[model samples]
Target: MASTHSTFKNALIAILATFPSILFYISFLHHHNNEDHSLWNWCNQHPFLLANVMFFLNVNVLFWFIALLQSSLHWMIGLYWMVIPVMLLHFYANHPMAQYNQLRSWIVTILTWIWSIRMLHSYLRRENWQLGVKQDWRYIDMSHQYGKNWWWISFFAIYISQQVLQMGICLPLHVVHSVDKPLNLLDFIATVICIAGVTIAFYADTQLRIFISKNQKLKQLGQPLVPILDKGLWCYSRHPNYFGEQMWWWGLALFGWNLGHSYIFIGAVLNSMCLGYVTMLVEENMVRENYRANAYNLYQKNTSMWIPWLIKSTSNDKGKKN
Candidate 1:
């Protein structure tokens, strides 16, 4: 349970976490296309059609954004954690036949809300907002943190556009989800895959946290944050954590696919593709940045980036040499 004193802090944390997301969305609609009247005009013409389309589109976009953002996870860790299960519950609730088992969907929604509540509460209590930095300094720092030398507007513009593309994946599933049928073997396999993927992600994250915390004491002594971690899961793949995460979303889509829904494939495929791209970019950049660190370079040379499949070095003569 959260302490009574933390209410204000919680509210502040919520704002900080949600602010960028909300603004990004607003800016997303504003800059994406020239016309701003799409929502209004659609609703004016046919309220029901507009509403359904909007809901469907938004949900798809949200799910895709959540998955991709989760893989990237720049600012809002709290939002990142809750977005997945909440999205799952949302898919369950807003599904067309959801009315038939509205109660079940609602149950899932409530559980998701609870999960969100717990995560948000923890973030507020634990986060060190670094409010002490000067405003200009903070802005410059954030530019480095969020924008990371990338153009801020363009980056988010691309990010939001990606969200739209990501959600587009669900259009097919939306069409098929209305069908009435018993579950099948494919469905079972998809579910298992989804569960395994998510579980692996969770495990990999847990391992990373342990790796970070192991060096926390070193950090307290005014040392820099550990530049590389090659222990535990890190030893296996430079980014087993990222690999696990990418698999999880793809797994979720597969689960949807097992339902024989094409829309679900859209959600999964786009997400996997985006993450796969980002993973390659980030890993390649890391290799260049840590070019001096022979160990890190060796790790990159030897291990797969987003795939667990180990890289076989034909150059067995190329041992770790300075």
Candidate 2:
């Protein structure tokens, strides 16, 4: 894990990660009509290559603007992700490669916009209106790991990596805008799933914020901090917010699947894998707390990590084992 963190901090090398993807995408875009290249002649091999390039290029354009906005993220931590749904809208309207399912694309865009608006509000409140001076704790931790070179390395680690994953997960939007098909009952199911995910996240974050505020008050008064949050959504899953986020991305994948681009699930799956990794880091941090460690360990034993579930007593498991 530490090595992975360092890998991202190697800005010169890490930035190369995106260079190839963008170049390949560009080569794919110009494969037929535009200029060609000898080395990139391989791009013309795939059929969806054109649409994929169109989507990728549009996303890159947005990322360029994100690049400027995120320039201060090392110190400011601004918003770049919420613009994804907007990119989908732009792509759907501008791409001339093929006629896609206009209705389906619009549906996906609207759902994403709702998610974006809610998340934007949540983030701004979390930010407390302070910009440039307040940096994200996660980025702070990483910057410490990278030491003085952090300023430069962060350009790739913080900005470039976010672009990669955000683009990956947003691939469902690309798929929806690239395919032409009739909507079905599955579309309704997908819509429900998407809404459910967003709802769960909204409530979970609300509960968590309340918990944090209460704990902060207790700390300020020289009282014991809450050892564990075992009420509401916290009773079922240790990280309902994470779970809901995965659900939201996976829900979007359903639309891609229904539209015959089932393979777009790769982006969602990879994003989940990364989230799972971060979940482990969070659990490790919880176990390190001297005051909360024991209670957190017990909670960890009974509570589901990603899936919400009823808390099963460990004594019952021990009895069954006997």
Candidate 3:
């Protein structure tokens, strides 16, 4: 059928376009290394490991593309959840440094895996995966915006772009795993910060989940939805979850910093900037559109946007005095 042929043609185009990007990324990784041994040379010596990593990337991309075709962009979240573990495992298997300090390596690997698992669990619970929910609101918004063209657009914009970002963001894992340095004072500080960030995010997400559940129950009983949460961590920062996320990366960057790998800090910088842009522009705009705009605007006036400690005077209170 003509339709079947057309679908195959689109898929082929996507695959072809993605191949060059993957190759470029591999080259980038190789060239970015400051070590004497090139990644290409290392790969040549470890052909099996190279093959496995390539297969993993290809399979992940193809899976995401298929999910896009099904109008299920939620799977992109899964791709992100898998990145840390996959990259960490790749380094563990191939890099000699991973075996240098078994305790330190285990500590890093276990912590990352725990965080990844927690994130995936939160996403699944929020999305109600058991009930077969297939997409998040952001992706749904994009689908509405793009209409018929969303299939390819989502593939490139959401899936492929995220894959690239994951590579950059997970750079710390690669560096840390491949370094023979023992855990130092900076590593301890980094660990404390990372753990604190994860704890904060965990609690913040719990509060959010509870709020959503209560709102859902109220709606079921024909009551109004609560527009804003201004208590607990929400009282300190408008986006504690996002702030925690940034802290987590910065902490990881500190680990690399302690190791004297300056370039590895790029992951934290880029991740923070990306989060800033998303939170300020995309997420806030969405909240203004979907929720009670006045309440959210008021919350924005009083609460710190990124820093939890810097609370401001509310516009409402100022107006009341006037």
Top-TM-score candidate index:
3
TM-score sort, best first: 3, 2, 1
Q: What is candidate 3's lDDT per residue for 171-190, written digit by digit as tens?
A: 66666655677777787888
Q: Which number leads on lDDT?
A: 2
- Predicted candidate 1 versus true structure: per-residue lDDT over 80-108, tens digit per residue: 44453454344433433332233322332
TM-score of each: 0.57, 0.74, 0.75
Error of 3 at 53 (Å): 6.1
Model 1: CA > 4 A from native = 1-88, 91-159, 169-177, 222-227, 288-292, 310-322
By lDDT rank, best first, the candidates go 2, 3, 1
lDDT of 2: 0.68
**lDDT against true structure, model 3:** 0.64
Please report, in order, the local distance difference test score of every candidate based on alpha carbons: 0.47, 0.68, 0.64
RMSD in angstroms between candidate 3 and the native structure over all alpha carbons: 8.1
